[model samples]
Target chain A: MWSWVAHRVTGMLIFVFLFAHVLDTALVRVSPEAYNTVISSYKNPIVGLGEAGLVAAVIFHAFNGVRVMLVDFWSQGPRYQRQMLWVVVGLWVVLFVPFLVRHLMHVFA
Target chain B: MSTIEAPRTQFRRSRATRSNYELWSWVFMRGSGLLLIALVFGHLLVNLVLGEGIKQVDFAFVAGKWASPFWQTWDLMMLWLAEIHGANGVRTIINDYAEKDRTRFALKTLLLASAGLILVLGTLVIFTFDPCPTGAATADVPSFCQTR
Candidate 1:
């Protein structure tokens, strides 16, 4: 139950980030002044924290997406669904450590 | 839950060989996801870890990145993959939860429109971004924008 919820919530979270990223990045086409003004606001601690949250969401969504792929593509995947979930968790942690360190360092620096 | 709970001796093997929307969607998720990992990680590494980290990601920084074909293609690919992947995922959620057909249709319609709008606008911006344009006042331009 939680896995389903987590997958959905993370998917939505990453989606929101994607939306904002595109819109903000598109500001480049509008005018340099507009783009610079908007992006400069992201320099603060609040947005840094939000970026950290986004990283977490991406980690979970990507790992779980692989798990979903496994279940969808592999004929025998459903039989080992429980095992696959554990593998996803393991992979998420392994992938996330470096990102965590980098983000924390930048946020506090 | 399947509306019909009857045990069917036959599976839709015939439909398996033919390419359809659902089939394409399934493949898209896996294929796009594989690409997304590379694109997203490269993006994070370049934008966040390289140079002065987040501090270096200002207007000129973005303008420079987009001026290159590589970053443009990368950003475009990321935009399409992430948006479609996200929209498809939400479509799944809607199908699972929305008992009323009308509600599901409305939600999906909204999702499709928003995703389409962003995809179009983002793609256009990526390809057409001009750091310095003709006839624009120097005062309103970014510091990096030199007068012609």
Candidate 2:
């Protein structure tokens, strides 16, 4: 149940990001000046935070995806689901630190 | 000869059935995963690194990039790969966790609807996007729009 909820939520997040990305990129067709303005908005600290959120979403979706695959298909994976969940948590923490740091520097510095 | 003839044994049942859908799905997951890594990383590197980096991205920048067929194709590939990959992954989860047939059907119905909607909307936005709006106030238009 938790997994289903998470999958749905992450799917939604990715979908939203995809739409935003297309819009943002589409702005270029409007004119270089408008494109620059939109791009500049992306550099704002708030948008930086949004980028971090996007990263977190992708990581969660990807790692949890692997876990789902294992439980569904692999013969021995169900027995280790709990262990895999922990690993997913650990991996997220590890990956998120660098991501946070990089984005912070990009935003603040 | 009589003793040998009496030793015939019964055949055991097979544990698993063959499925082309399952095989294709498995292949797709791995193949799309590999492609996604490249598409995703390239997307990141370009947006976050190349040229003036993230700060340099703007309306004109985007227009310039999309004017080239390369970026268009790249974005298209990423869109299709990620959507299909993520949707397939969700489908697998639905099959595994939903115990009731009705529940499964409902969830899958929603999933398909959402995926279809997103794919259609996304593709439309990509191909039909107009950077320049005609008859807009000059101030509202980008500088380049004025020149054109």
Candidate 3:
């Protein structure tokens, strides 16, 4: 159940990011100056936080993806699925902490 | 005395069918995942933390960065890795859960469609990005575009 939910959620998150990215890039067609204005808005501290959220989502999706792959292809994976899930959580914390710290410093300092 | 015979089911098990596609997919997931960690973080760091941070990001900003082969390659790698990784992951899910053959087929069809669409669109955007437009109001264009 968790796997199904995670799959759907991650898919949606990735799709959302892709949509935003495409739209942002399309701005270049409007005018470089206009594109610059939109890109500049990304500089905001709030937007920085939002980007961090995006990073987190991507990490989760990727890690959980690996987990799903293991279960699908390996005979032993189901035995360790729960353990692997925890490891993914651990890995996420390890990766995210430094990223968050650096982002905060850049935003506030 | 009576002799009894068992009937074979419709789904016959093939003993000799072998394909390395799954193995390659597995390897790709791990390899691309490791690369994604670095590429994604570096992307964030450069776009959001380096120099004047996100404020410096502009049309000219992208044009300047993409002007160099390094950034273009970086972006191209990221796009390919993430798209392939995510698509393969979804494929695994569809195989695992979608028991009905038609359902699995439909789901995978959709996944492939979306992935292919995104990949082509993204690649086009990255490679064909026009830093300068031929005709535009000067004030509405970046200074760099004017010079080109």
**C-alpha RMSD by candidate, in order:** 5.1, 9.1, 6.1
lDDT of 3 by residue, B1-148 (tens): 1954366645555555578877788788778877886887688778866786655666777777777789989988998888887788778878888999899999989989878877888788788876667775565445776655
lDDT of 1 by residue, B1-148 (tens): 4687469757664545545789788888899998998898899889887777787777667766876798989988998988999899889988999999899999999989889988999989987888566655565445566734
> Whose TM-score is higher: candidate 2's or candidate 3's?
3
Q: Is candidate 1 or candidate 2 better by TM-score?
A: 1
Q: Return the TM-score for each candidate structure.
A: 0.82, 0.62, 0.70
Best by DockQ: 1
Q: Can you give the DockQ of every candidate in the order shown? A: 0.53, 0.21, 0.34
* Residue lDDT tens for model 2, B78-120: 8888888877877887888899999999999988876776677
Each prediction's whole-model lDDT (CA): 0.81, 0.72, 0.77
Number of backbone collisions per candidate: 0, 10, 0
DockQ of 2: 0.21
Error of 3 at B80 (Å): 1.4
Chain A (candidate 3) TM-score to true chain A: 0.88
lDDT of 2 by residue, A10-87 (tens): 766776577567566555545546566667767778888888888787777678777877887799899999898889
lDDT-wise, the better of 1 and 2 is 1
Model 2, residue A23: what's the lDDT?
A: 60
- Point out the worst 10-residue segment of candidate 2 chain B by lDDT: B1-10
Docking class of 1: medium
